[model samples]
Structure formats: C-alpha cells, structure tokens
Target: MDIDNIAAKAAAKIDAVRDARVNAVKTAAASSVELQEAVQLLAAAEQKYAKDYQAALRADWTESDLRGFGLDAPSKKAGGRPKGARTRQSKPANDAASEKELIGTTSENW
Candidate 1:
C-alpha cells in the first residue's frame, strides 16, 4: 500500500513483460532458422530428384518407366507464397529517393 511497495510491484510487472517479450523474440528467431533449413533441404531434394529423372531419361526412360518410379517428368510449379495468401505491403517506390532528398539528414534520421 506504500509508495515504495507500489513502485516495486510495477517494476516487477514490467520486468516480467520484458522477459516474456525476449522469450517470444528468441522463439520466433529459432523458428525462422528452422524454417530456412527446412526450405533449403526441400530445395536440395527437389534438385536431386530432377537430376536423377533427367539421367533416367538420358538412359532411355519412357514416361511409363518414370511413372513406375512414382515420378512424373514434367515442369513443376515454382516455389512462392501459397495461392490465395495475402500479399505484404511493399514500401513506396520513391521511399529511397525521398530519404536521400531529405534536408539535413543524419545517422539519427531514422
């Protein structure tokens, strides 16, 4: 009920929130790294599969022969944001030019 006790309680709450934010940020960064590794692995596997399929074709593989191995020798869809996914708003095209043209800009401009 005293001022010192109230201040201490508020400080404790703030510290708890700060710790939670730090943990959340760390978790997000770790997840991002894992996602990147997974994407790279997927790309490598796709590339290897394509190379193997091409080698099979060079060895005189027919469509039926490739199908027997459960692979279709055809062009594939490019990797990108999923269909119907909302697009992120990009910065205005002139943002860089405007920034450079700003009067008396310094390192602290941001």
Candidate 2:
C-alpha cells in the first residue's frame, strides 16, 4: 500500500476513536436531564442551605456585633460590620468570648 493509504487509515481510526469517546460522554450526560438537574439542584441546594442559615443569623444579628462575640468564631454578620457604614447602638459586642458566652442568657434570648 502507498504510505498515504496507510497513514490515512491510521488517521481515520484515531478520529473515530476520539469521536466515539466524545459521543459517549455526551450521550451519558444527555441520558438524564434528571442527573444534570440533580447535580445543579444539589449545588443550588447546598448554596441556598448555607445562605439560609446565614440569612437566619443575619436576621437576628446586626452589624458591628463581632467585638463582644469575638472575631475567631463563625458569624452570620461577625466580619466586623460592612465597610464605610456607621454602627448602630444595637451592634454586636466586640468581645468574642463575652458575646458568645452571653448567648441564651441575654434578655434578647428571653
């Protein structure tokens, strides 16, 4: 066979293999909108789940409330109030240990 004939055959096979693999991935992924939906749904669920929890905390906690609550601990709003904004009187205590310890004991808890 001519060199071109041999090379052409090999190239065609390689292209076929590549096309097959691509098709396989596309087919499997396409097989289930539910699967895609489920993955997206999971991502969205996780995102919203975290957001919901944080939102709940934000609803209860206001800005400038990290001091008494401390900075090390997790916070829905404890990142030291948003920048460039004046703090309110109802701000969180800047004392982490003290603020965290005050949980469930403050008049607000009642």
Candidate 3:
C-alpha cells in the first residue's frame, strides 16, 4: 500500500519477466544448434544412400530390382540454362577505324 512497497512489487515482476525472456532465448539457441547439426547429418546420409544406389545399378541391378525392395530411382536433374533461354553474346573488339566508320567519329576526336 506504501510507495516503497508498491515499487518493490513492480521491480520484482519486471525482474521475473526478464529472467523468463533470457531463459527462452537460451533454450531456442540451443535447439537451433541441435537442428543445424541434424540437418548436416541428414545430408551426409542422403549422399551416401545415393552413392550406394548408383553402385547397385552399376553392379547389374535393374530399376525393377530396386523397386522390388521399395526403393525408387532418383529423378535426373537438368543442369545449365533452361530451354529457350538466350545467352548474351560478347561484342567483337573494334579498332579505331571500325569505330569511326560506325559512329562517324573516332576516339581521337572525342
């Protein structure tokens, strides 16, 4: 009921909230580190699986043989530019005479 008592209560509430926020942030940071490590492990496992699958194919295993074991062949990914995409061609080097012929003025005049 007194001013000092009221101030102390408010300060206690603020401190409690700040402590909760710090704990939450620390928990989330730890979880994020764990998830990043898990993702790297998953990627390495996927790469190994693909390599083994390719080896099986090279060892005279057919798609159907792999499919019988519930494994499907990985889809082929197309590399490079997509269809109908035009690449920019570099301009040819022009001598001073050619430049003058095209623009009616040479670098010397400029």
Candidate 4:
C-alpha cells in the first residue's frame, strides 16, 4: 500500500523478467553449439558416402545397376560461387574511349 512497498514489488518483477531473458539467451547459445556440431557430423558423413559411391563405380558397378537396387547416384555438391555473391564484370578495353566520346571530350583535349 505504501510507496516503498509498491516500488519493491515492481523491482522484484523487473528482476524476474531480466533473469528469464538471460536464461533464454544462454539456452539459445547452447542450442547453436549443438546444432553446429551436428551439421559438421552430417557433412563428414555425406563426404564419406560420396567417396564410397565413387569407389563402387570404379569397381565396375554401373549407375543403372545401382539404381535398380534403389541406390541413386550421389548428387553433385554445388561448387561455384555462393548465392548472392557479387561478381565484377570485366570492362571493355575501349571503355575509357567510349566514356570520353559520350561526354564529347576528344583525346586531343588532354
């Protein structure tokens, strides 16, 4: 009922909220580390599977035979630039000359 008692109750509530937020952040960080480890394991397993598949092919196992047994060929992993990667376009050899011509400035002026 008093101002001091009311302030104390509000402070306690705020502290509880802050503690919950901190715990949530800690939980997310722990989950992220676990996910990263799992992803690494998955990539290693995929690489090993691809290698074994290639070996089977080299040992005279035809793709059709593998498919007949329900074992499809390993998919090719994307190897080129990542999505949204910026690439610089090569300028033409006469780019400067074209620019000068567009601005009506001849080589004699320089």
Candidate with top lDDT is 4
lDDT of 3 at 36: 100
Model 4: per-residue lDDT, tens digit, 82-110? 66989889878699678868677655566
The pairs that clash in candidate 4 are: none
lDDT of 3 by residue, 43-68 (tens): 77777777778788989999899999
Worst 10 residues of 2 by lDDT: 71-80
Tens-place lDDT per residue, model 2, 5-77, is 9999999999999999999998887878768898888776666655555665568764345334642233333
> Scored by Cα lDDT, where does model 1 land?
0.81
Task: Please state the error at residue 87 of candidate 1 in Å.
Answer: 39
Could you give candidate 1's per-residue lDDT for residues 1-110 as a string of tens digits?
A: 69999999999999999999999999999999999999999887777777677677879988798899888874644344576888798778698677767744665586
Residue 50 CA displacement from its true place in model 1, Å: 0.6
lDDT of each: 0.81, 0.67, 0.81, 0.83
Error of 4 at 66 (Å): 1.3
Candidate 2, residue 20: Cα displacement in angstroms equals 0.5
Better of 2 and 4 by lDDT: 4
